[model samples]
Target chain A: MIENKTNKPQRDGFWEKLSKLNRRYIYMSVGICVIVPLLIRMRLPIFITPPTKSLYNVVDKIPPEDPENMLIISFDYDPSVMPELQPMGVALLKHCFAKKIRVACMSLTVMGIGLAEMATEKAKEEFPDVKYGEDYLIFAWVPGWSIVILKMGENIKETFMADYAGKSLDEFPIVDKIHNYEQVPALVCLTGSSTYLSWITYANTRYNETICTGITGVIAPEIYPWLQSGQISGMLGGIKGAAEYEILLKKNKLSKVEGTASVAMDPQSITHLLIMLFIVLANISYFVIRRKK
Target chain B: MSTNIWVWIAALLTLSVYSFLYKDNPIYRFAEYLFIGTSVGYSIGFLYWNAFIPRIVRPVQAGDYIVLIPTFIGLLFFARFTRKWTWLVRYPIAISLGIGAGISIPLTIQAGIFRQLQATMVGDFTISNIIMVVGVICTLFYFFFSLEQKGVVGGVAKTGIWYIMIAFGAIFGYTVMARIALFVSRVQFLLHDWLGIIK
Candidate 1:
């Protein structure tokens, strides 16, 4: 019989006091830790992961001034996840525009269309050289999830009759040179849910399109197997992925690049260290109290 | 964009949501209700313009009568609320389920199972790859519930439990990062966007 060893420390006076301590105090400290780093513009050392670098390489390798090497960036998140995900979407568009990679943009989710527009607004403002309809096109969210995915391989224009603003696809100069998943080199989805999985299942399998995903931290681990399988070109797992990309772009001397993700990193590192500190202190207190008992 | 009232509204709404961390108050409840109401309102409007208008109306305006097939099938969904017509709802539900299951099965097998197995089998001989290969096999062995645990198989299965625990620990660490990120973002908003403390 397998003996399951349980090592739970006895809760005594010390544990009770720590537990009863004002919750507001904890919240206040967390707030201070995040804010102090931001005000000073504190820079944190970022170790870019292999996956993040692979994503960077894939984006960097998109041949400049070539409309045929088209990229599709789909925004599939909402305001709730805007802070973590919006930076990723904005940074990716910045990279594409900076490299002059002709791209098409869409959203799988209804909530995502507004967020997609926000990302574009930020990116386009920073890089004024990027013109609408010629350089990039924005598509509206359509119902029928897999139906739309399947339609992309056939007639992408027919999939959605017009842009998000109700302008026909023919009006877009970018679509003149690029149509369907076949013409596109890479399809990137910055999503908060399993929307990336659908892209992998449909787009990658059927049309043999090279896909890259930028997902939230929660779903990032599940995507590792796919990354290892080489079904995905690259992955940006959460804002860490975004921060890594920002560091790479900054290293390349891309001026006026938004460092939002990198800025978030200082707070991220500090907060993580703070959390570990709390856990260690708690454990130490627990063990010391148990010994006294 | 100087002194945008909408920004102030957003900041207030954000604070109201954060207020729940303190205690449930009328302010939090009001904001929560308002958020849900606004989201539903916006989604309805967006679906009308983006999906309903473009996909259905435009195709009909262009004399594509074949599009009515899917439209009629969709209307069957509304029949669910009526007592007499409740039976009619099952047709759409059945159709959707049938279609969804049909689409998902082959793709799930190809991407989720077959490719996963293939990747594990043909991985290059690296430290990480070797660990992954062993971990995968052991983990698979742990799920063999039919046979009683005995000798080497039992030991391998036991090792699989450790790998599973380690994987879970990694996921938990990532989950911590994600939660911290959410809190940090709200603070970022309050500091950088609202107060303009950080530039």
Candidate 2:
């Protein structure tokens, strides 16, 4: 046959084969690598960075006031980034509710309303007594991004007349008492976009509200200088950031707080290591081919 | 392993999208189309329910005079569909751009430039602080393209390149982590929520 006559493995065939590897095989390997580690529990050492610790300290040390008006945690990202940012919402809610700190949760982005609702609902399951519109409230999404934040500094109820479910703010005795950013002690903005800038511009600078941010990993480094300068009070960079927060709570001998962020870290760490190994292998093959040529 | 129909749908759609890692085919195209269609449809429904219903519909019903101005301006967006009245859309666009520009200039100068410059000056006197100060100066000089590369400027510009490359590498590394985090999230959903293989 023509294959038998012409086809023979060359002396340098190994590197050439590696260099010409099909993309599908690599994809499959990564998929398998992620799924296998995910099927079991692996406790990865999550180093708690100072920025993340600062956020925890801020959230933790907030005075548990009567009627529980302490923080406004803004859920500003949709489901597309729920994987990275939602964990922070869940952890923050658990931390607040457990400490008996009242929070008024809202979202600036329309798509983030569902995520905000989901995170709040999930956290409340742990502590059944944390009633909606009492200990915690979901304001949901308003139309204006920067305008909403600006108007919120003036009057929150005027900006959002009601909560997510068409209920009058008048009915909720807890939320009715809360108005404007001046009343708010701390604000945590979790976002997948540039909505954080609006919060900083209007909410922080104008009203002088204490603001922390939990942003996606891609935007983390860009905002690092902000954290160092104390422009923002605290920060959670990504899922790993969320995991670090979860760890901080668990270490304090608090209630069970292990959730998606901690569970997902194992696969994340393994996949990252696998990627590095592949990069090395790829470069080796590239160099081998170039030197031979 | 999962009884929920929603989980099954999510799993299948995720697989279809991941199929793009191989050569593009009908499955990937279907997934892509589905995602776009779903996003647009969801946005319309969400904005209406969460925004327009409460902010406009309820307010105008109660005879709030202030609500009418924004409502009229919003209607200008639909003018793009009409040939003769397309130019009318410019009024709303101009108002928005003017407002946005007016707001952005001061805020950007305050937060983006002023606060950053303020941060650089007032850091603790450490080795990292020294590096940061040097890095910022060199990086700023590197962007000065008006002046040709001469001896001292060239040396400073070269140092600036190094800082710029390091920052870019940090960004690239974070970008990789972001992408991997996204993909891994989908896989986690498949395993934990969809398949119920792990909890």
Candidate 3:
């Protein structure tokens, strides 16, 4: 027992142990927190936020009969961010397909091509009636995203002369009337990077096109100023945002398939709580250890 | 619990990657290398088939001499390999930088500066709007180094610190959520997609 400045006997090594806790213990705790909730499913209520609702409303308003019902979805993320952004992409595709709204899907990054394909495949499994080249078109990735965006603003056909499969864009009736951003009602960018700013800069600022975004949560706060400035029409932030969109889809009877985002929400909530608890515990341990020293 | 070959392969790769959390080992290193190598190979293949062929090779083969000009300029990027011809790389570099700057400056100003200022100034006088406007001014004041930060400027800058701290806290929270979301996704894949333990 050691005496401190206040003449109080020093406590035992609990605080010291906690302060120097093995990282493997924390990892195991996180793993259990994530897996348990996922195994024993719980239906946690998902409240829809305004930004997500705004995005849904924008997509909902596009008339199916309107010749300009085309929506350009840019998948600007890779597998590293696929966990957060893929659900958002799949939900958006499902919404568009259910509403009979045409889609022109493209990836700014080559790595995003696989993710885009995965999302589209997942959505297509639900909408078996939806035919490719007529209902939707997937454009292949090109180098220089900023220039590609600007070129698409001028003429989409010239920018993407062919689809992802090397078929000419002219062969697709979905893009027959969509010459550029003018014919598309809105361009929804799903990104894990700052490429959305390029859309805001080149597409919205240069051509005055409507731009919305579904971004990873890490970058969502940075986009608030753009949303406030009316540069971005609406936004979906992270997996939570994807879950909200899924709720909207089910409520509108647009999708009957269970959404992966909604399914993962319970685990996400539990893991968040566990992390918060760990942070508080660490702080307390740090303070206690400092006092003891 | 799963018989699918692809699922089995994915599960093994995922476990290999997760093994790093316990201790770094050869399995984790192999998985890491595999990921990097595969990503690079995929990108090369995608660019060659989609971009190089469509934009350059096919066009050059079809009697389109105009495409050769840009191709030749792009080829100049390889000049850096030779010391004497390295000066030629500067032409393409300068052309790219010039074009990029020319295209981005006005658009960046319009999207980032003017519109933001307009929104901050002209919005309705709601509580949130007022807070935004005041926060913006205080933050700008915090960065203003012309005068001594002593009087009201100091007070405003102090408030700016609070705003910046709050913003950082929110971003930190979102970052945690993003990371947790990734973990949850992997868990879901293992439980549902691979093991069929969850529906």
Candidate 4:
């Protein structure tokens, strides 16, 4: 050799190999971890976190007053995040319907309209007596994001003169008593993006509207500061939040059917454990390789 | 198994996307392009009906010619296509930016700064609150470049690094959960909705 390194003999091929493992193998392992528990019908215990409970309690406590008891649910996500968000949307709708609380659904993103319709339809299947014009309505998505929120604060009917079907909102009794954030008890936003901040900024800060969020896991940690500040009344974070809400609904007899979030929890838990194990293994391999060098 | 034709198409597309895990292939590319194309098409259609017609066409048809003002301003955005007329695009851009700033500035400061500061400072003296206050202060110290980071300042900055790292770790964990949840949903569709193998 031209010049042998000081510790050339100390190199371990095993650590080096482990450190250099193919990403495809890890992906396959994750796939297995996700698919296996789902196939085997494994059930994992889902602990209800405080934030989820707070969300449930907030919705539960809304007085079932006529049209004033109405809740505005802003669907701010698309099909891409429907996996984590749609279940919570359905669960919330079911809860609202079960309690006889009216809902006015709208979308900030155009793509959220389909998701909103899907969720409403799914919840409608369970609550057959729920009427559209009387018990709920779907407002067509307008272009502006923050401007829409600010406009709704002034007059909801003026902002959205018609529903999604092009029917005048004045024809619907649901919008008769509900005009702005003043009449509604709370505004629940289901989102996978930072649009919840718009609700906090315009809806809560300006109009004093109570804002609650059901958000994707990626934005969960981001909401804690606002949650602590009482800017957001409650939150359901990630799929686990959905599962917890489902459990709460089941316990309260608001939902009889098993929700998708509840069913997915088994796979979710197992996948999380598997990922944590991989993280540990990768760190161990790196440390071992470094020491050997 | 789902007898619906649409469900079958969706399931096949989902599989096409998953096929990328093995290696990049034409099937994956096809599915990717299809998704992008469909989304863009849907958006354009939605905007035309929901925004263009309702906001501009309907009002103008009803004799409210005032709506044409904003419509004309919006059309100016197309001026960027011409070399000589490109400067006209800035008028609408400036107006929108001015209005956006007017709306966002006060609300942002209230929601993002004042409320957060109040919460951090005026919270009850619990152990968690104490830790949070300290963390906030130290993190602010880390960002204060005016002071030379040496001795006590350096030590506090290092502590701030620990908090920052811990926050990053938590976010990473949640991101992983989110991605896995998406995968689990697809698998659920394949098993329960498509194949009817699970309920």
Candidate 5:
């Protein structure tokens, strides 16, 4: 006892002590920090940079009703990713509907059906006069994602026998003209995984279909090669990309629901910054302890 | 307060969930448990509505005995909870795997393997495309089984690593930008949406 047994638990220095706090404590503080700012309606002025500008231009250039024009929306994500993707899906659907483009929706993942339905429902709510059969059709989820693309290019009708609502695809006026993949002007993949690469291989390879992607931030890096090599025309990755797409749709005066993604952006930014700071501090502490050793 | 009060309460509970990051305190623990319970409850409800009621019970009630095939398979999933009956789960797994593989591989061949090859072969011949092609070739060749690395082929393979590194760097840079975008979004939320200080 007199010797101060165990050397007082080897008291860590300032930086070391800071690093030793339970990770959950830091996580909780971060949660509060992010939530408080979001609730207060704090937002930064977003500059319309080149990437966002390009995204806007692409959507703008497409005439909403060009008959030869076909837009494919691939729903490859589930409800877990809805908080980030739903807004983007809604915005994209709104833009296509406003333009009067024929919309063909397909799902690779089973959960994607819900997301696809939500998009169509939102579109119908805003564009009330829009007829389902005449304007759009929802393809039921298929098991094989890449094969579905190939089959779509080869024989679109054989691929999707009925719409999600059980309506025959042949009865859908909008989809009546889309017998194959070559008719599609663009393919948009919304996924939380690297299935974008498969789109490249299938659509771009067999059908020569132009592809774009809206994927989660976690899976963004893996798809850059396609983006760089011109296999993909554009990409909207993660929450930030969603916000950017919202700005584009909002600016066009298409839909007011654009605020959903933009509102969430602030909290996302703050949390990221905090995480980066923590990482830097952790690294500095690691180096300091190592040098002392 | 009326029936709509539940919405506000739910919102408050959702926020409380976020509060757990500060510490593993009671509020966070409570929220965590609530989320688990609610999620399980919702899933069970969904299963009953979407799976059991529509697929099994309704079919049985309607005197469609054919539904029993799927009904039996569905019940087999519960075998996962029993150590003795665990092998029964594999029957479903095998069927699912077979479907998954049959669905994915041929299509993957058409997409991931064959389609990628076709793209590379017929790609644009511009300077950027050419560089990309070279990188792709070198990268592909780097994994060549017959080509040993001791000679010029080895040198090219080593150079392939450089190309790969560059590709990786570009991806990394894009990732950084994406992360930065997330950060910017969250910051804007705090400043503009939450505090009304910025817009």
Candidate 6:
């Protein structure tokens, strides 16, 4: 019922109706929007920007024989963010492993352990010879990120005693000879949350200004200053950033190399366009209905 | 035959999982449950192999009594299950928190607060960098500590808001493009790989 005193349309059933929608309608549409394009194999043109270039350069510029030049892969995302972050994880891992660089994988997020495994698997597929303890080591998921940062900085061994493979860090030649934050060359923070800031405070702060970079989803807004100030050497934020990284890796040719980042792009595009169209239509309808009334 | 059978099984599982988007059907529910079970099982296995085995069992077997401390502390996390013993969980949590907090303080002081301030203060005078520096100063002062100003400070603060808005706007725009790219990638996968509709 429209209130005659006010000119505004009745707001009844607006959100409640949307809330009551049969979830399938939304899910199916989203699924088709995602799946159909995958079946069709669409490769969208990507514009490489400074952020991605900076990320690329960071990886590219790693001194070839600097064994102390280690890259810390911090997984700070969970399955809820799997659709967005997993591809970035896989691609980043593949790049590091292919370059034959030593890596230290750790997770702050509880769910990050599985995601980190998925990344290791992707890298392992290419470099089957890369042993778990020797080539790359995963630190156990540290519960409170801030404290973990402190422990890692103060004494690496006191914070972590062993790798993920049930072997002592002391046993692994690559890891045993390390002490603290100063030994690591670069840190790649892959997250869907703000745990990156903790690293920024705890790890990157103590080191040289240019050693940290990050891969984050799109919702993050506050890190732009860090980017501009050269506090973070590079950043790959969101799926487009991942796509640009893939282009850098030249994975466009491989059939399955087109990972979830590619697959999820379809629904994302259609949904945004759909939302825009609906906004325009609703505005038009509002004007029309108002003018008539 | 074995390889082909595995391929068929995988395809069936994928289809069943994908069916959830259609509706809350049995196939989708089954797949969802399966995924949950598998994930939990995998996690339990990982915890044992990754944490318990190496940190506890092997160390003890190797005759290292020192390993018993962390091993005992980690098991303390399970105290959450017991009503009386639940308070014990705080010990490990405290230790973890202590180390994590200790690391983050000095780091944040340097990276989040100090380095950011320094970077904003000193830089080359390119057009983009200048605008950025201006934005940084105005935004910083926008949260000013000193005297109240109705006119110029307010204007600068207002301009500061605009600068932040514009910078955030660009970030948001880039985010949208990235999301769209992800959606596109998914569609391409379904078309080319699953159905073999495109080459």
Question: How would you class the docking of model 4?
Answer: high
Model 1: residues with Cα > 4 Å off, grouped in runs: A1-16, A285-293
- Candidate 4 vs. true structure, TM-score: 0.97
Per-residue lDDT of model 1, residues B146-167, tens digit only = 8776899999999999999998
| lDDT score for residue B92 of model 4 | 99
Question: Which lDDT tens digits does candidate 2 get at residues B1-199?
Answer: 8899988998999999887887789999999999999999999998888778877888889989799898899899899999999998999999999988887678767877788889899868899999999998999999999998789999999999999899898877777677778888898888778877887
Candidate 4 local lDDT, B1-199, one digit each (tens):
9999999999999999999998999999999999999999999999999999999999989999998999999999999999999999999999999999999999999999999999998967899999999999999899999999999999999899999999999999999989999999999999999999998
Query: Each candidate's lDDT (Cα)?
Result: 0.83, 0.83, 0.89, 0.91, 0.70, 0.68
Q: What is the DockQ of each candidate?
A: 0.74, 0.66, 0.84, 0.87, 0.19, 0.35
Q: Candidate 2's residue-wise lDDT over A128-153, tens digit each?
A: 78888778887757776788888888
lDDT of each residue in A1-293, candidate 5, tens digit only? 11234555455678777768688777566656666766675677554544445555665566576656678888888766665566667777788888787777888876677689888897678888777777777886554566687788887877867676655677766766677876787788888877787787767755688888887766776666566556777877777777888887777788765456777766666666776788789999888777755
lDDT of 6 by residue, A12-114 (tens): 4443344345766655665565556555545655678688778777776665435566667888887655656677777777677767767778887767876
Window of ten residues with lowest summed lDDT in model 1 chain B: B1-10
Per-residue error at A190 for model 6, in Å?
Answer: 1.6
A231, model 1: CA deviation in Å?
A: 1.0
Which portions of model 5 show Cα errors greater than 4 Å? Answer: A1-11, A47-63, A66-68, A123-126, B1-199
Q: Candidate 3 clash total?
A: 0
Best by lDDT: 4
List residue ranges in candidate 3 displaced over 4 A: A1-11
Model 2 clash pairs?
Answer: none
Fnat for model 3 comes to: 0.84
Candidate 4: misplaced stretches above 4 Å? A1-12
Q: Taking chain A by itself, what TM-score does each prediction score?
A: 0.91, 0.92, 0.95, 0.95, 0.90, 0.82
Clash pairs of candidate 3? none
**Candidate 4, residue A249: how far the Cα is off, in Å:** 0.3
* Index of the highest-DockQ prediction: 4
